[model samples]
Target chain A: MSTRFSPILICGAATLFSACESSTTTGGGVSDAQSSDAQSSDAQASDTQASDSGDGSSDGDDGGLQDASAEDVVDGDDVYAAEDALPSDDVPVVAEDVQARTDIEFPSDVDEDSVTDTESPDITETDVPGVDAGGPDVDFADVDPGDVDPGDVDPGDVVPGDFDPGDDVQTTKGPQLGEPCDLSIQTWCGDEAVPTLSCEYIEAEWVWTEYNENGLPCFCHPASSPGPAICAVPGFVGIDQSGRDRQAPSLRALRRAARLV
Target chain B: MADALTIDFDRSGIIDPVFAHFAIPVPTLDVPPLSGVVRDAAVRIWVDRARSEYVGVMIVRKLHGLLVDLNAPMDLQELALRMLLDEQRHANLCSAVVGALGGDSGVTFDVPELQQPRSAATLESQLIEMLVGTYACGEVVAHTLLRHVVKALPKSGFRLVLQSIAKDEVLHARFGPTLLASIRAGEQASWIDCPGDAVISALYSAQCRWMLGRDVVDARDVRLFEDDEQARAMCSVGVSEPRAFKAAYMAAVERVRRHARSR
Candidate 1:
């Protein structure tokens, strides 16, 4: 009957967008005019600290995307950066060390309608990975359901011991990283961990197989790890089954401890 | 059957071996017999989702364009592209669902162009609109709805397609507010107050109309089968749950509000 919120949902909620600390170049606002301020802000890095200096200068700092250094991503979703302090009824909160973002400025004077179109950045093309074979029969491999072992789950085995789900909900057991499963299962590993670790299927490895197969494996991951934390399945059913925001705070942790950042 | 459009989508190209650790597993469909009303209803849901996913693509493309035009952070722009790719793949998956149901993909492909909010005044307004509508509200709602649908699925490939699609939306949903914060950083003005934000409300209403196929005036006007008797009947087969989808929509919108710190 305890109604405690998970630290991940409470502290890392707004920052689920990304992981790691990167150099950010700001150039936007309600107006179409671009700001000339070339000053760059270092994206938030490390843990669940939403580092707000309280000056309101660097107000909404963070979005530290998942970087190559997985070592920095100790707290799953917080890997991106610290989010604004969220409204939690009662929970453990991470300290946000936000610096002043005073340097990045927006254009106060904007020529809305008459503005020249800014040349869109050409992001390097990643090789599209789907439907390429276009063969008579789809390329999905048959899944071996027997490969999944519930005994291998036991969230304690996958998630770090520090995290607490906050609410009264008991920690649910599920398949571990590389353990065969199907659509019927999602990221169920760290339903009770901080900075939320997901125990679900990885998207990149998803392949079709003979019908009614459950060949996919589950892993612990952050609810939303930037870059490639084994892209989460379609969505998370890891949280509350009723779909209540308060109840489903069990974001993601990791599929396997070693694979992703 | 020859006239039916091909909607089955499968990933076959070389998957980067680097990501093999802790890779997500997929399920296969146990093809079910298609007939009468049940089959028809399943087709309608997948077709409708296909349209939404298609629009999701257009919206992200436009959003990427806006980011480019505004000279937003390169990282933000890149995230937009990532979302675009995800939506494209998702569209293919939805097509696969339609094909499995023995339906036409064109029914979804033929839908209208993505519409911009009439209240948007500039590229900036438009960008925020995309963040709120597409990522914030739409993705958030879809994430929750897919969770339920995945459980209801009859241990078939239908479940695999949906579950896979659902996971991608988590980051997309979180990206909504993160991008918004990046845009509105240090500024006290709330983007939720923008006139274009009203469009988000209209979108929810529009979804109800599409699902129920009529104007929704009040609670009494809801005609979708929410009763438990039909729970396993229609919803079990790929159709959306009226109450669950709406609740998720409301929850997503609230998350946006909290993120904006407007309350």
Candidate 2:
């Protein structure tokens, strides 16, 4: 998907530049033919140079590739033609990315948008993914609701083999002791963009999402949403009537899980 | 495997979760590898202590519920709640002690018997059984056992917590007498004639018998009445004291039996 979008971004930048040049030339002494001929030739030369320089190195002066790497430049994007490409017409990319990158943990008692936790150890400050279980300082990272196993006693429950990275994210085996992988996303390099996904232990509760349909409550991703309902972990197998997912285990069940009985 | 009752409480949201309050501090023992002897003893001690404290909490809570059940005025109810809360605090303290010594200290219970009306006639007998058989008999006896632990365990935070819990139990025992007097006054207590004497003596005897059965208590340790060296030690056979607790208890039992027989 990312590879297909690259060429379209470059073309859009070029179009914007041409429009500005044409508008400026209209107010100057240069004839429309001369002005358009010069700009068109310049654009062609830049495009040709970009294609020849192996992943747009010659067109490196174009700030479009400023954040992307050489292999991911315009040459990589050439796989998608301009006709097949669509421009990023003020599509609120930054906002969506911020929203999509919802895997980060937030403060327990703060607003969803306020990313900093005054009393907590900041997620960005720690390189180690999960809570430093043995650290002097306890950091309760927002657990991934799917990874919780309070009574993970059975050896057969071990997540099979080492984790493999792929597109289909689903669980094939239950969790077990010391199984060092996330089951929801079939990945191994551990989503560098969102390190929380690959932690050894994630303790999260079930959360309901606004988009739930069929009147069935759904466990929501903490990364994309923030509400009291977002972190309420549901029990073994029950959902609330309002269609909002419930994570509050029955008091009796909680006691059993805690080994109080 | 975790107990089912604990699971039920975990789900009910009635009591706060164990992790919310208890703190497990560093352990002081020099436990060796695969040394099941030391580890097993430690684990046993922890389990026993947790079990003991749990009964205490259950008793106090049940007693509190009973006070409310009897429709005893507000003053009596308030007194019972205070005692119940004290018992909970003791449970919490014991839980912290167990955790500090590297034991999992959550309290779990099975789903309670189905909720029947509070006014059921059988409730009184059940209350009597729980109080005489479980609390006074079970928990008070546990205190006798833990008295040995306080001495055997090396001086540390765990011992300190045990001491605190024991002190609370001493006060808790007084509740029996107060409630017993009230039951006698109301004539609602189960046993006919000298019911208070019968219940108190039975509980005291049952407690002694149960404590002695735990295998930890040695007969040579009975020191509540004697001046012998073994008697001075914490694990002494204080339960066998001839002239002190047992004498008073036996006399009370004889009185209740005579009254019942004459009637």
For all predicted structures, in order, the TM-scores are 0.40, 0.33
Residue range B69-125, candidate 1, lDDT tens digits: 767767666666656655665676676667767775354121112221111136565
Tens-place lDDT per residue, model 2, B1-263, is 21122211112234454422322122232222323333333443344344434444434444556555555465545544444444444444545444544555454322111110111224454344344434333333333323323333333344444534433332233233334434546553443223344444433332322222122311222222255432232112111222232222222223222222222
Candidate 1 residues lying further than 4 Å off, grouped into runs, are: A1-261, B1-28, B108-120, B151-154, B187-236, B247-262
- TM-score for the second chain in candidate 2? 0.54
Candidate 2 structure quality by residue, lDDT tens digits, A59-160: 122111111221211112222111111112211122322221211121232232221110000001111111111212111122222233222322222334
**Best model number under TM-score:** 1
Tell me the tens digit of each residue's lDDT in model 1 across A1-261: 111112233223222223301101121121121111111111111122223221111112111111122121111211222332221211111123211111111122222122111100101111000111111221112322223333233222433334334533223332223444333233232332211222233564422122111111111122211101111112221111111111112122221222364
- TM score of chain A per candidate: 0.21, 0.15
Worst 10 residues of 1 chain B by lDDT: B209-218
Which numbered prediction scores highest in lDDT against the true structure?
1
Cα miss at B238, model 1 (Å)? 3.0
Model 2: lDDT to the true structure:
0.28
